[model samples]
Target: MSKIQFKAMVVTEINDKQFSREIVSRDVSTLPVGDILINVKYSSLNYKDALSSSGNKGVTKKYPHTPGIDAAGIVVESKNENFYPGDEVLVTGYDLGMNTSGGYGQYIQVPAAWVVKLPCNLSLKETMIYGTAGFTAALSIYKLIKGGVKPADGNILVTGATGGVGSVAVGLLHKLGYAVIAATGKPDAKEKLLKIGAKDIVLRNELDDKSGRMLLKENYAGVIDTVGGNILATAIKSTKYGGIVTCCGNVASPELLTSVYPFILRGITLYGIDSVMCPMDLRIKIWSLLANEWKLHDLEQNVEEVSLEGLNTKINLILQGKLMGRTIVNLDL
Candidate 1:
């Protein structure tokens, strides 16, 4: 194929404290060894990708790298027997966009183990709309349900409710018939949150409890906490006895400051969600559910579609916590 040339968003470190991004030409031959090579059609922005793009050495060890954790496309070539050219597939997490050349490019070469065949009834674009954010939300909900949370139990709380994972979690919980309470710092987004199925809106400040009381009056049956730090600690204390709380992202802060009362006294279950290393069997199962019964009909409602050239703005917005819902990238543009 003469080493197909394509466009990609490249991040290069200008100095120890300065980084730059631009769309540049790249060749397929530059891709690392993998079992499959994908002609990437779509990708989505994420907080981790932003960190990597901005030269967060913790998320990415090197610069002059591509940062896209989520991708969907058709297979162009394969060394693995399970995948064939022309097959539609997607890849998320597993070192992609981190240290690996990711889907911000028009192509990606990933291990066979990291690839998932596109589920029926979902298009490549639609899959990117969900992406890793939706997958994390699904994993949180799945763990909650498996921990014995039910729709009839009580109201469920989704923190950071305007962000990608939080928004998707609210929709999925509402679709499953749970009363969802969305918490956000942006009061202007109340109507948008409600449109996505949040039954009520709570200010993010309300959840940032500073009262040293080890326990608060239990309120929620379960919680999908996307923001860690004091918000997560408050959610743990405020959850009803025996309730389940799933912790995913740390946009608020990674340091969780609280006591063990919520776990010991209230018998609450706290599940830490790790979408990056989720097992393949469970990953496929969750993707199937998302494509079928759990799929959100309005998945594209609040989503913004952008091109590789447009991702720079969205990345800055996400890093500043100014972006809402999802932003999917169309490589063809």
Candidate 2:
């Protein structure tokens, strides 16, 4: 068969420390060798995708790559029995868009193992809306719930609540009947946060404990902290005894400067969430919940849909911490 040609946002190394990204044509054969080939329909941007696009070698050691970590599409070809042509699917984490040609391209070839059959309740566009950010939020909530925290326990604080993961966390927690306190530094986002299901709003400054307290007053029953560093430390310090705190992102800072008091004194349980390399069974379970019981109408609010041509601005916005909610890229556009 003749090689299929597709358009993709390619990031090229300009120097030892600089990179350039542009929309360009690529051959299907250029995709990394894998068992499944997919016609990508939609993809969502994430902090990691911003890093890869901007020459963050840690995320993409190789240059001239596509930098989307999440994709929803239909299989065009499959070498594995588990998938076949015309099957709808989605992919997140697991080295995709890191070292592999990802969903930013109109077509992608990936290991069959990295693909998840699209949840029955969700459409192709809907899956990209959730993307990795929503999945991460769901994963954090899953762990929080499995840790035994419930709505009646007390407030569940969602740090960085206006961003992709945090917004979804707010909506999902609210849908599940939790009293979600959305925290953000953006004073203007209160309306958006409330619309996304936050029962209350907390200023980001409140979560940043400046007094160097090893432990703060017990407040949250549990916390979904998407921004790491001082915020996570503060959340841990303020959690109710035996409360659950899940950490999934480090947008503010990766460092977690904290005293052991939260664990030893308050008996707080901190679960580090890694959506990447999550066990297939748990991954499927989370997606199913997101598709059914955990699904929320509020997640699609404040969402922006863009084509590959429009992704550059979104990337810049995300890198600067100015982007709100989720932005999905339509490859067909």
Candidate 3:
């Protein structure tokens, strides 16, 4: 198998501050040593992929690397007893993309612990559709439900609602009977957000609070914040008493500048979401939920399919915050 060749997108450094991305041929022998070798059928674009492809050293520490954080495919070879050739599998969020060759390539070899058997009723393409973004959304919703925030309690605010995580969260929440209030910086995304189950749309700018007041009018019973910074701060201040809020990303700004008045006065609960390094049992459980009850049958309504060659265009769009919904990369195409 050392002579077998596969196509992959590789990012190379031109200088300290510059880099280049291009399609290139790589050999199976070049793959990292691991227990499983997969023929990746599909991958997806995320904000982190954009940063890695564009020489964001913070996301990727090395040059000439692949940057897909999500992968869904069939196993081609395995040394672990739990896996065998021809078995379906998926991988996400455990150093597969960062500092390691990722799903942007047609193949990947990873540790057995990082691989998950494809759940019942979910196709490889469908799993890539959910990807890390959707998985994170699922984790956030899990927190909200487990924390006692019920759909019948009140509205659920999804900040950055037009992005991958927010859009999936909107659809899943709507399917679960929650009244979703979508917030986005993009004005034209209102229709798409509504089509996917948002009950109302609020401009992202509207969620930002310039007032010096410690707290504001109570509206939402729960909040799923994907973008950090003022939007998160504002959501905390506006949450209803005994409400729950789950935070996942810091793309807007990592620094959260807010006081504890919301917690102290209203007794609100703020939960942080971390999909990376999630426990194996919980990871399997979450994926099972996504495959079954949480599955969005209309996920295609918000999906955009692209080939490996087309991924570059999406990387640019995501970096500029222009990409909408989910964009999955098709290796077979």
Best by lDDT: 1
Clashing pairs in 2: none
Taking the tens digit of each residue's C-alpha lDDT, what string does model 3 give over 1-333? 446799999999999999999999999899889999999999999898899999999889988898899999999989999999999999999998888899999999999999999999999999999999999999999999999999889999999999999999999999999999999999998888999999999998898898977898999999999999999999999999999999999879998888989999999999999887989899999999999999999879889999989988898888888989999999988
Q: What tens digits encode model 2's per-residue C-alpha lDDT throughout 1-333?
A: 228999999999989977889999989988888899999999999989999999898898988898899999999999999998999999999999999888899998888889999998999899889989999999999999899999999999999998899988999998899999999999999998898788989999989988977889999999999999999999999999999999999999999999888899888899999999999999999999988988786556769999999999999999998999999999999
Worst lDDT 10-window in candidate 1: 1-10
What are the runs in model 1 whose C-alpha is more than 4 Å off? Answer: none
lDDT of each: 0.95, 0.91, 0.94
| Count of clashing pairs, candidate 1 | 0
Model 3 Cα displacement at 114 (Å)?
Answer: 0.2
| Higher-scoring candidate on TM-score, 1 or 2 | 1
What's the C-alpha lDDT at position 273 in model 2?
A: 94
Q: In model 3, how large is the Cα lDDT of residue 179?
A: 100
The TM-score obtained by model 2 is 0.98
Q: What lDDT tens digits, residue by residue, belong to model 1 across residues 157-210?
A: 999999999999999999999999999999999999999999999999999999
Error of 1 at 192 (Å): 0.7
